[model samples]
Target chain A: MKLEDQRTTVYKVDPDHPETESLPTLRTEELLLNMGPQHPSTHGVLKVILELEGERLVKSTPVMGFLHRGVEKLAEGGTYHQFIPHTDRLDYVCAMYNNFAYCRAIEKLMDITVPDRAEYLRTIVAEVQRIIGHLFWLGTQALDIGAMTVFFYTFRDREILLDWFDELCGARLTTSWYRIGGVEKDFTPSLFEKLKKFLEYFPPKIDEYVIFLEKNRIWLARTRGVAVISAEDALSFGLSGPTLRGSGVDYDLRKYEPYSAYPRCEFSVPVGKNGDTYDRYWIRVEEIRESLKIVTQCLEQIEPGPILADVPSVTLPPKDRVFTNLESMIQQFKLFSQGFEAPAGEIYCGTEAHKGELGFYIVSTGGGNPYRLKIRAPSFIHMGAFDFMSRGYMIADAITLFGSYDIVMGECDR
Target chain B: MHAIAEKIQEKFPAGFLNAQEWRGDLAITVKREALHDVCTYLRRDPDMDCDYFVHVSSVDWPDDEERFEVVYEVYSIRKRHRIRIKTRVPEHDCIVDSMTDLWYGADFMEREVFDMMGIRFRNHPDLRRILMPDDYTEGYPLRKDFPVQGKGWRDSFDFLQDPN
Candidate 1:
C-alpha cells in the first residue's frame, strides 16, 4: 500500500461545531505502578503497588515479607538466652536497642531486678544507641529527599558513637552487650572518657545537621504537609515513637510505661503538631538532643556496683568469676545449656525503640524455650496505615512517607 | 479481679470464661462467639477507652480440647492501662471475629496471626498471607507441629545439586 493510503482518517475536527461531536473519546484509567522490592529509596526490600491517577497516588498496597527470616519461629526452638543475638537482626540499623529490649523482656519474664549501676549503664548505652538511630534516620531521610551533604555530616558524627560502641562491646552493628538480667560488662575508664568526649562533640554537630536541612527549600517543600495523619488515626493505627508523636500524640512508652533508667533521666519526649513528614523529622532531631541529655544525666548519676544481677539461677556469672571459680563455671554451663525455667504464663513487653514500640509477646510453659513468641514490629504496623496516609500525595512523595516512619524491612517482614 | 475484668464480666456474664492478673498484666478469656462484642465494648466504652491496638497473636496447644488460643492485646492511651483478651478455638472450627473495623492497625496484625497460626478471622476486609508468599502451601509455621527446619522447600531447589 502507498504511504498516503496507509494513513487513514481517524477523527475529523469540525470548525463549525465547537463541541467536536466527530472527535473520538480518549480512554483513561488508573495506572498501576510497582514501587520496589529492590528500589533504593525503599531503604530495604519493600514493594508497594501504587495505583496512580496521573501523578497523584490514588491508593498504595504495600507487599511485604521479602525479608521474612521467621525470627519468631526460631525463638521457639532456642532457649531464652539464645534469642538475644537473633534480636540484633530485627532492626539491623540499631541492634543494641533490640538487645536491650529483648533483655528487658526476658528480665520481666524471669522477675529479676536489674542492679542499680547496671540499670544506669543500660540507660546510657541505650540512649547512645538512640542517638545513633536518629543520626542514621536523619542522614538516610535527608538523602532520600535529595539532601546529600546532611547524610555525610550525620554519618560522620554517627561513626564516633559506633566506634565508642566498638570499644564498649566487641562488634559495632550486632553488639549483643545486654544480658538478660544486666549488661555484659561495665564501662572502663577509657570508655567513660570517650563517651564524655562524644557528649561534648555531639551537640554542636546535631546543630550542624539541622542547619543543613532545616532551611533547605527542597527539603521543606518535599516533607512539609506531606503524608499527614491525624492524632486519632495515628493512635488507632498503633503508631509509636516519633511517627506517632509527629501526629501530636504524647503516647511514648518511655514516658508512660517508664522502663529501665528512663524514669531516672530528665529528657523530654518531643511531640509535633502537624503530623506531617516535616514534623516527624523535627521530632527526630529534637529527640537526638533529648537523647544526648539522657546520656549526660546517666553518666553523672551512674554509680559503681555489680553490672550483672546476683541471681545464680537466672543470670550469668562474670567472665573473671567463670575462669577462677568452679561453682561459677558450673552455673554458667547450666544457664547456657538449659535456660532458667520461666514460669508458666505469658507476658507482653513493649520497649520504645527509635523507630517505634518494638514489643515481644512470649508465652512460656515452664520451660527454657518459649511456647510461642510474637514480635509486634512497629514498621509492619506503620505500613498498615500507608494506604490511608499516601492517598493524595504525588508518587515521588512515597519515599518521604517511608522515611517518615523510619521503617526497617528486617523488623517489618520478620 | 481488676476493675476492667469486673466490668467485662458484669457486661457479658455468659461470655466471660476466666480472668487472671499475672505479672501485672490482666488477661481475660471470653467465649469465641462473644469475642467481637467484648472488643467492641472495650473500644467504645468511655471507662475502658482501649483505643490503641497493640498486637494480635495466637498460641497453639495440641493436647488441649481447644487446640488454639487467639490473643488480642490493646492499650488505652487516655487511661494508661492494657488488657489482653483471649478466646479459645477448636481445631475443626478455627475462626474468630476480626477487629480490623474497630482498629485499623488490626488489619496487618490479624493478617499476621492468620498467616502464622492458620486461624481465620471473620469479617477481615483483605485477609491474605502476609509474611509468607501468596502461594505458600506448607502448614502454619508457629504451630507446634510445624518443624523448625522448614517443609523441604529448600531441599527441592535445583541449585543445591552437585554439577559433575
Candidate 2:
C-alpha cells in the first residue's frame, strides 16, 4: 500500500447497522488538549490546540500573540532611530541580528551606504549572534527532549559568548549595538583578541555537543525521521535558514542575496538529505561551524577604520564633536529631533537572521518615520505549518517537532 | 522583471492595473477580483513561476477611495526572481481572495492580516485571529485610524478574568 493511502485510511461506520450499534458502542471522540501558553516544553508562551486520537495527533492548531507587543504599530509612531531598541526586544536571544536586520532595512530605506569596516564588524557580530542563538536553541531543545546534560554543556559554553556581547555592548540580552548607518562603535583591541579566542574555541565545542547527541540511541530514536518535511513542502511553507536547509533546500538569503560582508566571505551552505528533527538538529550544529568559519574570515579581513558611515546627516555626530563644534551640535540636534527623511517608497530587506529570513517590509511616505512596517518573522511563518508537520505523529514527537522549528515567541508574536 | 510584468499583462490584461519598480523589485498592481487567478498563474506558469509566498500584509490608506491596500510578496525559487502584487480593497467590502489553495503557508499570513487589518479572505480554510485572542472584540489594531495605546483595553482588567 502507498504511504499516502495508508495514512489516509478512513473507516466507514454504518450508524444504523445492528452490528455497529451493538458492538459495545465504543465511540472514540477526539480529545482536545491545550499544550501551551504556560508549559515549559512548549517553549515561550506558544499555545497549541491539539486534537488527539490516543497518542496520534489528529490535528493541531498553534495559538500565538501571547507575547504580542505590537512592535509593528509601535514602529509607525516612533522615529527610525527610536525603533532600533525595540527591534532588540524581538528575538532577544539574538538581539544583535535583530538590530542588524532592522538597521539594514532602514539603511536601505534611506539609501545610506555603510562603511566597509562597519559591514565587516556587523557581519562578524551577526555571526557571533547566530552562534549564541543556536547555542540557546540547542540547550532548550535538548532539555525539551529529556537530555538535561546537553543543556548544561551548551549553556556553559553560551555564557562565554554572552560575556563577549556584554563587553561589546553595555547590555547583554538587548544589545542594540547596530545603528542605521553603521555600528555604535568599533571593537577594542582587547575585545578583538577575546573574539579571536572565542572564534578559535567555539567549533570544537559544537563538535563536542554533536558527538554527545549524534550516535546516542535515545536521541536517534527520538529525532530521526520524525516531523519530516520535504524540500518542496518546506519552501511552500516559507521555512528558511537552517529549518529550510535541513529539509534539503538550498535557499539561504545569505548565499542567494549576499548582503553586508557576506559577499566577501567564503562559506558553504550545509543541506540535509532527510528533512527530519535530527536533520534540523545536525544542520544547526553544522551551521555553528559555518558561522565560526565566517567569523574567522571576518576577523582576518577586518581593519581599523571608521565604524560609522560618512553620512553625517543620517548618523548622529560624535558626542565629543557635538560638544566642541557648533556645526556638530546642530547636526546631532537635527538628527535626533526631525530625523533623516527617507524617500517616499516601500522596500523589503531580508537578512538571514539566526532563526530564518528576518525580513522587514518598510513603507516610508517621505518622512523620518515609516508609514507601515511589517516584520516577516520566520518563527511566525514556521508556526503556520505546525499543524501540518505534527499530524500523524505521536504526542511525544510533537515536542521534537516544536524544538526543531527553533521559534522565539517574541519574534513570532511581534 | 519588466518582461515578467509584460507577460502578466499579456496573460491578464484586464486584471493588470499598473506596474512599477523600486530598489530593483518589480511591483505590479492588480484588480482585487483577479488575485486568485493571478496568483494561480504566478505559481503554476512555468515562464513566470513564483512558488514561494513571502508575506501578505495590508496598508491602511483611510483617505484613499479604496481605504486598504493588500500587498502580496512572492518569490520564484527556481527563477530567483521576486515580485510584489498590490490590490486595493475598500473599507465597506473588506473581502479578498485567499492564496491558501496556491500556497498553504498563506494560511497564517492571511489570518494575521485579517486579525490586524480587518480584511477577510474569500476561500481561506480557517480564517481566525492567530495572534489576538478569539474573544478579542476590539477594532483591528493595524488600521491607521486606530489609536496607539488603544481604546481603554489596557486599563481594564476585565480580559484577565474569565467571563464564564
Candidate 3:
C-alpha cells in the first residue's frame, strides 16, 4: 500500500537540511526521511536532514561542507594572485563576481586601480553576469514551485548570456576574467556591440517573466506570505542582497560602497515591502531591470583605452613588450615569479553580487601572497533565515523559501 | 566626498570609525574596546544608524599585536547608510562579547562566530562546532596559525561519512 494511506511505513531522512525540531507528537507514531546529497532537486552535493510528521516537515537542519575543500584556508597557503582562481569555485553561478570581489580587494590593498575603460567594461560584464544569475534563480525557483515551463523560457536567455561569457573567457562558469589591477584583456568591440544588443532586447524578455509569473494568481498564492522574515531578523542573521532588500532593508554595497566605477553609473536598487518568498522573487525581477539600466549606461560610457594599468610592478608586462624588451621581460619574470607585494594592511571590499553581498577580506603582510583571505558568503547567512522563517509553514513552504533566498551551494559550502 | 557619506566625515574625526577620505573613498578603524559603544551609538544616534547587521566576519592579523579582527558591518534601512566596525582580538585568547542580547537575530550569528572563529561569546546560550563535525579536534581553521587541513590532518570523528 502507498505510504499516503499507510501510517506504519517510514521514509529516509533528507541529508542536506533535515528537520531540526523535536516533535513529541511524532515521538509515538511519526516516520522520519532522508532527502539527498545526490538528487535532482538537491542540486550538487547538498543534503537536507529532514524530520517529518506524516509528509509534513517537523524540523530541518542544512548539512553543508559536503564538498568543502577548505577554500578559505587554502587561500592562506596560496599567493594573493593565485587565489583569484580559487574564488571561482564559490557561487559557481556567477564566478565573475567572485573573481571581481577578490581582485577588487587586492586592488584596494595595492592602492592600484584599473583604467576607466576597464572599469566601464567590468561594470558592463558584471551586469550581464547579474542578468544571467537572476535567470538561473528564476528558472530554478519556478521549477521548484511547479512552474516547469518557465524554467525553459528562463534558460533560453541564460544560455545566450552564458555563450557571451564563453566568448570573453575560455571557461563558461569559472572565468577568472577580472584581474587584480584590471581586466585580463581589452574585450573586442564586437563583444560590447553584442552586449548592447542583449541589453536592448533583455528588458522585454523580463516583461515576459513578469507576465508569466509575477502576477500569476497561482504563483503568488504559493509565494505570498509563505515564509515572512521581519527586517530586523533578516539583518540580525547577516542578510544581504535581495533578501535584506526584500525585508525593506535598503542596503546595497554597490550604492553604499561602490567599487569598479559603480558610482559613475546611475541605477536604482529595487526593494520589496514584505520579506517573503514572493517579495524575493519580485525583487530579483526588478533588479534584472536595474541591471539592464547599468548595462545601457556602461555601453554609453565605454571608451577606447588601455584596459590594464601601467604599473608593471603589479600588472604583467604586455606580451609585445615581453617579446621585444629585456626590461619588460624581466618585469614580467619578476611579476610572475615573486607576485605583487601589497602594503602591510588588511581591508575588506564587498560587491553587491547576484547571490548577495559577496565580500573578500584580505590580510596583506607586505608580501607577494596574502597572509589570510576570508570570504563573506551571503548564502550561509541567508540560510540562517531559513529555520526561523520556515516554522509554522507546511513542508512545501521550505522549497519556495529556499528559492526565495536564492542560495548557491558553492558559496554556502565555502 | 559622496553626498551621503561626506556629511558623516564632517561630523566625526578623520580616524573615527576607522574611515578617512582617501581619494574620495572611505576606510575607518575602531578599537575593540570602543567597538560596542560605536555600534550602539550608530544604532541609536539619528545621524548614523547603519543598524542592519549586513555581515560579521573576522580577518586573521598575524603580525600585528592583535592577531584576529572581527568586523561588524551595519546598514540603516531607513537612511540607506552603511558603516563598517572592526574590533581586534589577540591570538592567545580570542573572545568577543555577545551582541545577541541587543539583537535576538544575532543568536545564531554569535554561535556561528563561536563555530568558525572559536571566539568565545561571553553570554551565548549554545556554543558548539557548526559546519563541522561535533567531535572533530582542531584549532579554529579561520585563524592564521591553524592549518587548512587541520594540525594532525587526521579524521578524529566519524559522525559524518559513516556508512554504518
Instruction: Judging by lDDT against the true structure, name the best candidate.
Output: 1
What DockQ do the predictions score, one after another?
Answer: 0.54, 0.53, 0.27
lDDT of 1 by residue, A272-313 (tens): 999999999999999999988998998999888999999888
Candidate 1 segments exceeding 4 Å error: A1-24, B160-164
**In candidate 2 chain A, what residue range of length 10 has the lowest lDDT sum?**
A1-10
Query: For candidate 3, lDDT tens digit of each residue in A132-202?
Result: 89999999988888888789988999988888888998788999998777888777777877787887777
Q: Model 2, range B1-164, lDDT digits (tens) per residue? A: 59888998998999999998888778899999888899899899897778777999889999999999999999988899988999998999989999998888999999999999999999888787878877788889999988999877667665566668
Q: For candidate 1, what is the DockQ-based docking class?
A: medium
Considering the two chains of model 2, state its CAPRI-style docking category.
medium
In what order do the candidates fall by TM-score, top score first? 1, 2, 3
How much lDDT does candidate 3 score?
0.74
C-alpha lDDT of residue A349 in model 1: 95
lDDT score of residue A44 within candidate 3: 60
Backbone clash pairs for candidate 1 read none
Chain B TM-score (each prediction, in order): 0.96, 0.93, 0.73
lDDT of 3 by residue, B6-39 (tens): 5444444432454543323344566665556556
lDDT (C-alpha) at residue A100 in model 3: 84
